[model samples]
Each structure stands twice: as structure tokens, then as C-alpha cells.
Target: MRRSFKISFLLIVMMICVLSGKCRAGDRFIRNSAFKGDRQIIVTFAGPVSDVWANDISNFTVNEKPDPDIMLEIEDSTLSLDKTSLVFTFKDPLNREVPHCLTLKQIIADGRSQGTATVTLRKNYLAHLFSVFLGAVLIQNFVFVKYLGLCVFLGVSQKKSTAVGMGITFTIVIVFASMLSWFLYRFVLKPYHLDFLQVIVFIGLVSLTVQGIDTVLRKVNPALFKSFGVYLVLVISSCIILAVPLMLAANDYDMFESLMLSLGAGVGFLLALFLMASVRERLELANVPTPFRGMPIAFIITGLFALSFMGFSGMSLF
Candidate 1:
């Protein structure tokens, strides 16, 4: 009993460290702007900034149009020492209907000159949503692009019907799990600085959710449960299942963006599974070489799929 307790305690500590480590943000520029018929735009950076960098109108440019109806004149520029943000108030209020572009020639931060920070000011929320969806599905696909959740992708993709079932299950679970994890991290863990416990908390939430799903399936349709019971159980430990929430936490995506990302990832996983299953199903009839018969052929096909997905690299919605 004492040994078991010690093992459990070590596991808990490890989980805490993992979760806390996951919450640490990386070096990246976070941009935010506000327009309420006001000419002021605030651009914030979550990273560090050097105090020696000049904060002046000469350092920034607005509206790249050669000949413009409305010219953007920077009245004043202010830099936050603690927050590492730059705020600019324009002489004229920006046109909300038309998109505006701004460029910072040199943003020296952390003793390093960030050569250029280009920002496009567009309040098109729908476009942003579509971009997020497209990115998640194609560019950053969980399986092909990100190489996540391969175990389930390869294991249950032998048949199209089974692949579709697993895809649906994954979609439902991932979407719900991401949203739940985001709420927990944002409200409960982050506020209290208990983010170190995120790994354990997220895994616990996912396991409970998968269990709930299994219970429901077993009760409502025993035949279906018998068919895909093992796959459903395996989802609790699926890397993709955990990855979605971890990414959401790391990127600090809002609720809507997180939901879209989860949905896109699920759809992308489903698409890959379906394609692989169809290809594998056809391969069974083909008289292939003995060396490249089963798993070998599957891996080759997956590599081809990954290559195909590479076409979406650097694709931008805007």
C-alpha cells in the first residue's frame, strides 16, 4: 500500500509539471485593435520589448495606398514599459468599412530587432472564422499535417464504415473536450495559477467524457458498442484527443476559435481516415509484393497522404 501511494504521488507531481509546462506561452506577436468610430488603434505584443527602441511616428506607416482619399496621420505614439504594447492615435478616425494596413519598420524587443510587423485591420469576424476553419482542416490537420492521433487513424481505418464511425466519435468528443478544457483553463486554472495541473485536469475531463459516451452507447445500442467498443475506449488515451486542448491552451484561442479549430481538426481526421480506409480496402484485392502487404503499404499510403496535404502549406485565407 505504501509503495502504491508513493507511485501515485509521483504520477500526480509529474502531471502537474506537464500541465504547467503546457501553459507557458512561446515567443509570438499577439495583435489586437479597436475601432468605435475612433481613429485610435492599439497593437499589443505579449513578448518582451527593449527600452532603447524609438517610439515615434517615424517608426510606423499607415495605409499603403499610393493615392488615397483619406490619409492616416499618426498624432502620437505611446509605448508601455510593462505591457510591451504600442498605441497610436491617428489624426483622423479610420474608415471601418474599408480595410486598413499598418507596418512597423523596426520593433526592437528583447534586444532583438523584429524587422517588420505588418498588420491588416479588418473587422470581418466571419472571414477570420473561415480562415481558422480552413487552417485547422487543411494546413494544420491533426493527422496528416500535425501527425497526431495516428494510432486510431491506422487501427480502425481498415473499413470505410468503421472509419466513418470512428471519425464521428472523434469529432463529437474533440469538439466538446476542447470547449470544456478551454473553459476550465481560462476560468478555473489560469485565474488561480493552477495551470500546472492542466495535464491531469484535461486528461481527467477527456477520460470522463469518453466514459460517459461509452456508457450511453452501451445502454442505447449494445450492438454498436460491441462493434466499436475497443476504439471508443482507446479514445481516452488518444494523443489527438489531448492535443486539441493543449494547443488551444498554448495559443490562447477564444471560445469561438477553439470550437472552429476542434471541428476542423475532427473533420480533417475523418477525411484522412476515410481516404486511407478506401485505399486500403482496394489494396486488399491487389496482388502486391509480400514485403509491402499490410502495415507497410498502409504507412506508404499515409506518407502519400501527408505529401498531398503539404500543398496547403502557407495558404492564407485573407
Candidate 2:
């Protein structure tokens, strides 16, 4: 029994490795390939290539995906002086979010060897995910740039402790709910032609997630839970939480992308809340005009924060 169990475990692990795309079995002639910037491919060969074969445009083909049908137009194909590398420049920028396939045909290398092979090219997958994460956190911040989640942004930002606590809780809820929404959209609704029911379905998922969190938090740490107060209930309908799921569905983001985006949005909202709390805390001490003491001054300060956050727009990670 033990031996059988071990064998089963090993089999499962191997299957996972293959499914995760870690198993690349390309020919040795194709030493390596990588995406250069976003529009070019840098392929290193096992040996120096013949200049004649390397320059022919027909010798190389680029496709958007593994499917042979969706080919990209190559504007130029140049061989490095050493002839061990080929640089393929495309007419348009490659989509960083999707993997591209490159095929080499009748390629003579080292003045003798000739072969054909295909390689999968993509921006470092983890790097792409990081770019997506950072873009969501800073570049596309919901609170400051998209004008989202202001209700909680204003309601809980009065005290640093409150703001920070709400931020943490909101992060947990948003990530969990977004993933659940993605699963349902990708598997259930999309397959069944029920896309129209997404909004109503997501609302239920959010409410369910918030309810579960509310119950668990009420038990594990009542202080933090009580600190949440009515705002915990408000998360069910918070524009920030709801928007993440809708964005995931609309953009057709994969599981990792959905997670990064939801997580980034949560963290951005937290930053917004903390900053407001800090400023508001200082304002409580400083002398202020009677008319603009509370929410009024807070709004003006928030506008300034939004303006500062606009500086992040220049960052284009994708």
C-alpha cells in the first residue's frame, strides 16, 4: 500500500510539472529564445548560422499562439555578426499577455548542420505577472486614479488603526472573492452561455465571501472584527470588490492574472486609506477653518493625492 501510494504521488507530481509548461522538449539546434523588449525575438542557435538562410524571411515564421493559423507579419529578420543569433522584428508589438510561437525552417547553421524547429516565446511569465501586479497597484490604482472604493476610503480613513485594519481585511476578501468569481466565470457561466448572468452571480459570490469572513473574524479576533463594524457589511457592495470580478471576466484574465489584479487593487486601496488616515490624523491636531474641518478638508486632500498618483500613469509595464 505504501509503495503504491508513493507511486501515485510521483505520478501526480510529474503530471503537474508537465501541465505547468515547465517541460520543454525542443531540439538542441534551438539553444534558447527570448522576447526582446516587446516587439522582437532574440533566438540563440547552437552554432553559427549561414547568412543566406538567416536573412530569408520565409525561413522564419511567427504565430501569436501555438495554433499555426494566426501568423504575425515580420518586418525584418537580421542575423547577428557572429551568425549565432537571429533577431526577428515584427510589424506590430507582440501582446505581452499571450505566448507566441516561432518556427524556423530550412535553417542551416555552422556552415553544415541544417534543421527546423519551433520555440515558445514569451516575456518572462513571472515578470509579466509582476508587471500586471505593479500596473494594478500603482499605475491603475482604483482609489486615486480610477476613483473607486471612495466610500470605504472616506468612511474608515478617520483613524490609522481603523484604516489599516480595514485595508488588511479588504485585501483578504477581495482576493478570495475575485478568484471564486474567476472560477465560476471560466468554468460554469462561460461554458454554458450564461455570461449575461455574471453581474448577479458575482454579487452573490461577494456577499457569500463577506458573510464567511464576517463570521470567522467575529470569532477569531473580536477586536479587529468589531473595529470593522458596519463597513464589513459594506464590502459586499463596495465598488472596489465588485469591479475586480467584472474586470477579470471582461479581460479574460487567467487565474494568476486575476489573483495579481485583485491583490494589487486591495493593496492600492490600503495605501489610499492609510495615507488619508495619516493626513486626517495630523489635521485633527492642526488649527482649521470651521467650514472645512471634517470630510470637506478630507476631500480636498484626497483630490491632491489623486493628482500626485497621476504621476504613476507614465509607467507602462505592459
TM-score of each: 0.63, 0.80
Model 1 spans > 4 angstroms off: 1-123, 220-230
lDDT for each residue of candidate 1 in 1-318, tens digit (9 for 90 to 100): 896899688657645754674342222464565443467777778676664564657877778333345457888877776756767888876655345677777778777877777666655767777888888888988889899888788898999998988888888888878877987897789989998898999999998878887897899899978876767776775698899899988877767778899999889888989999999999989998999988888998999999999999977755
Clashes of 2: 0
In the range 1-318, model 2's lDDT, one tens digit per residue, is 896899688657645733575555467788899888868889998888899988889888888774579789999999999889889899999876677888888678656646678788777778888988898888889999999888778888999988888888888899989988987897799999999999999999999999988887888888877777556776765698999999999988777778899999989988889999999999889998999988889899999999999998867665
The alpha-carbon RMSD values of the candidates against the true structure, listed in the order shown, are 13.6, 5.1
| Candidate 2 pairs with clashing backbones | none
TM-score of model 1 vs. true structure? 0.63
User: How does model 1 fare in lDDT?
Assistant: 0.78
Q: Which pairs clash inside model 1?
A: 20-196
Global lDDT of each candidate: 0.78, 0.85
For model 2, what is the alpha-carbon lDDT of residue 212? 84
**Candidate 2 global lDDT:** 0.85
